[model samples]
Target chain A: MISLTRASRWYGQVIGINDVTCTIQAGLTALLGPNGAGKSTFMKLVTGQLRPTTGDVRVFNQRPFANTHVFRRIGYCPEIEALYDDMTGRSFVTMLAAMAGIARAKRAERVDEVLGMVSMSHAADRRIGGYSKGMRQRIKIAQALVHDPEIIILDEPLNGLDPVGRKEMTALFLRLATENRCVLVSSHILYEVEQMTRQIILMDRGRLRAMGDVYQIRALIDAHPHRVSITTSRARDLARRLLEFPYILSATLDSADARQVTIETRSPDAFYDDLPRIVLADGYRVEELDSPDNNLEAVFRYLVKG
Target chain B: MVDLYLLRNALRDLASAKRLVVAAILIMGPAFIALAIRLGMGSQFDGVLTYGTLAALLVFGFVLPILAVVFGTGAVSQELEQRTMVYLLTRPVPRWRILLAKYVAAWIVISATGLLAALALAAVTYQPTPGSGRTALNRRSIVNPRKFLAQLQTPDSPVVDYVTQRLSAETLEQLSRWDPDTPAPRPLLRMVLTDLNKLIAADRRLYDPADFPEINVPDDARQLMAERPRGAANARLNRWLLEAAFPDLIRTNRTTGNKLYRDVLVLPVGAAAYGAFFLLLATILPRALITGLFLAFGWESWVPMMPGNFRLLSVMTYLRALAPHARPQTASTDMMQIFQALSPDTVPSALAWIVLAATTMAALALALAIFSYREYVPRDDAT
Candidate 1:
């Protein structure tokens, strides 16, 4: 577990992270943000690579900065792509496993096991310099997992992966979360983090914007108007029917296609409940129904302005 | 086990083929220069002078310090430059241990490369001179005391004031116009010998081994001590005194091969201090390589030349004390003589050893302390 109490980090006049606080427990919790959103700085604080400029960052109830005990319990995968180019991936993993205090007799087994988990066993013997970006990302993940840490913090871990690789890594993160380990992944890719977990801490401009389940966050932001698009032959009739409800803020009939109408309403649940009744009673032809505000992207867009 | 892995990783990085290539060039550079000197100046080549100049100016002064800066700053900067430091720093090991392990690896490399340069220079330039032969030492002393006595004839020697203080006015008068060429005035010669014996007994820095190469004492006194005849009667009594008087001139000349080995012994201690200083520099300043080079060449080059007690602050001064060598005179190096004249001070061998150890410990301790507490952002990540 990691906890940040009014944690703020600054690089000279530039802020890395502003006054932000959160607690992360055992599960795959994505840190959602855009570029320079202070995600990497936040992760660095938890991994003991940096000290918070003005707050208390505690990992497992101890300050993480230069604290070897805390370091042993946490594994960090940084965003930087550079590695010891001359070293083979296997040797790189072994070296880190040794640094992690893994016994020599079991280091090889542990290294191989992690390499297999990341699907890097085939290229494990090759020099890292020759590895593709996907391979490099996997190797980074492998090193983070080699020590069997209780908490794994990865910054932009899915940056360079292919579609298939992304899916596999996402699944791996999900499986890791299921093992009762705290997995905190930070990414600017909103869709990718959404695929990993609904549990997230959303940030923008170095400040925590929102934290909790996507639906839960969405439910809390009911004051924002929601858009619903419906394709029906009786677009005029449906618009008139939708306007009868007070929750409907506006209705725009699509001019290019006369059969479609888009309605804006603050209360989507009430709208959805009344929509089928209106359609069934009128005997109307409702060929398609869709709402853009139904998923994490809409929730994220609604939560953080960025 | 973690320490071992850290050392191995650092050593592997240091011994990379790319670095080895540069180190090879550094190691062979002196030998190549010596070859050119041997070929161009053949027969006229004073092996002692050639070896001394190259060893001091080229290898010790330039090569050694430059390597220390490159290797020292490179020890940690290399990891950060490659963005590999994050991996090491995140491990369950103390930051100081990681840095110290890398420093030890860099120190081993700089010391070895410097020693090789010195050895290669000595090997290429070494020629059997008069006192170089084992049995030849008994017959031909490196110093021709007759020539020395002729040079010492001037009355206003460094000893003029020394004798005015220690001897009777009568003895000073007899010693003033002395000459070894003319038929001997036995009593005056005996007086000169006795007075010289007093200087030897005093254990003064006037003829310090470190100063022997530079030979900066006032003309008269330096002339007397530069080389003395091993008169059968005086040899037994004065041998130890003469050696202690100017060991660099006597020992380095008699055993040319060991000069480099002796330099080898001193090189690491010097590198350790220089390396530790650079390690500390890298920790405090981001542009440490540039700053270190400025300090290595700009500060270190001239600080030992600074007037008065200021020379005591330089690491180079102590290094010269630990392993004195003949600093060959050249137009560019005339600044060294000027500084030597201005600061006629020398650190004793025992003191040099102690001070170097203390400074090295101090620098490493400070570097370790700063590294332990501070945070380093990977350069790419910082942007």
Candidate 2:
């Protein structure tokens, strides 16, 4: 329900987002990036908080920059931690709900309903200044949801949540997505988003790097030669034998470890499947096996570098 | 709904205990001074003169402007400083409506503080005027004879001419030796009053009421008794008749404290003008508070006394027009009063009202327009 056409923003000479085009539909979609990867800038554009310096941003086919119609349809949870410290969570939610044009008859009910949704009902009447980071996160999300907008953009919403809170929030996002609402969540961490959705738009250095299913992106990362390290008394023998497999691209012995052999292969599944057979046949003792490619950081490294 | 919430939040801030304490402190400043004056100079108290000068110099010129700058400008800057603006701006309400709502709150605060300060000054200094003892007279109410005494000390005052021909050379020397710059002791002023009173009463005998058939000698007697007529009487009989009117006129009275109400009433208008201008400045400029202080204290302090119609440019000028103060006999050399004390000008109250209203509306409209179009996204260091 949101689209960006060659959207780019700059702060003086520093680039925030550069020449990025993307469309977000009604479902769960994670914006994945490292810090300074323009994810927040992209979120601000979609949420109508800012206009792109040289591009078009549309929400529901209308430009979203300071447009009330788009604003009424979109909810935003910003990454900024500052909140109205003196106000109660309920008061904060009620104020925003009122501004969101919720009728007075339903404003209080909606504020309460959203506070419950974020599991903030118990402490809703307490001043937000006394709230912990997790409570503050929940309240921010509560305010965003209080308006009942069709599209919700959350920037680093999971940053301060504990494991259970994170899990609950992920489940909440999953439920919202199932209801056919557009939920665009941005984060620098991969595993946090991995729990919520398979679809992700990866960005790095102000440019869109990849966009698709999480596994597909992983597969794209895997297409490059993957490294698997093995430790054994006969490391040189295993290196010599591992080359017989057609999928194994190369094998090199670790210079510091006499018993370790590192193998490179484009087909990780095939190499893994054949390694046990090769070791069983050769009767070479294998003590340990490890793959650096299992990590998303390593995946980003391989993809972003390429 | 948006307007209600915005206004409520702004009012809530004003209702805080900290603000209450600040209000108490500001109002006490004028109260204590009035008390000290009333106690120090008991029977000789002149509330009109005191309230007139202090209200104009302190309340209208200083307190109102400072309060407007802090509260009015803080309506926007405080929100931006705390980064709470993002929440307000990102809502479904139009930007201008939000700013207008907040401005209303600031205006109320500024007007209320100014009103309370004036009320405090008026309450402590309230006294029945010494002459009529009923109606509170303004700067024009020459309740005190010192003003006339000061008038008589002038180089070619007609009353001085009238007195010179009658008094001994030694008494004339006392009148001459009494410097107008440094106010003469109270006894010396009374001595001048007694002489003038005696001479004018004696002069009235020169023309019997029956002799002047056209003059309404009984009813117009008090009216003529009120002021020193600046010699419109060149004819010998007219001069004698003019001198005849001085008996009741020279029976000088001190000003009552109740006269401060007009000065008090003019403060809200001043608040609106100052509040709107500074509110606009805060929205447009980054360092608006400092600029506002300079303008309020530095620019407004002197523009009203800039030798000509230049007072037309200052908000203080219109306020002064709406609530004019009686100039004190003693010359005040402070920067706030230096120019205003030296240069006295008359402004039509109607013109002051129209200009103030127009300036306030124009500033508010510009502030609303700027707030609507400008991007005030509080910078997030994270991104």
Best by DockQ: 1
Can you write out model 2's per-residue Cα lDDT over B207-324, one digit (the tens) per residue?
3434433232221122232232333211222323433333323322324343455655677788888889998998998778899999999889878777678778998877776776
* TM-score of chain B, candidates 1 onward in order: 0.73, 0.69
Total backbone collisions for each predicted model: 0, 2
- Cα lDDT tens digits, model 1, A39-132, are 8888888888878789889999999988999888888899999888899999999999999999999999999999999999999999998999
How many clashing pairs in candidate 2?
Answer: 2
- Estimate every model's Cα lDDT from 0 to 1: 0.78, 0.75
> How much is the lDDT of residue A271 in candidate 2?
79
Best by TM-score: 1
Off by over 4 Å in 2: A218-223, A226-294, B14-20, B131-156, B159-260, B331-343, B379-382
Candidate 1 residue runs with Cα over 4 Å from true position:
A230-289, B16-18, B133-137, B142-253, B328-333, B378-383
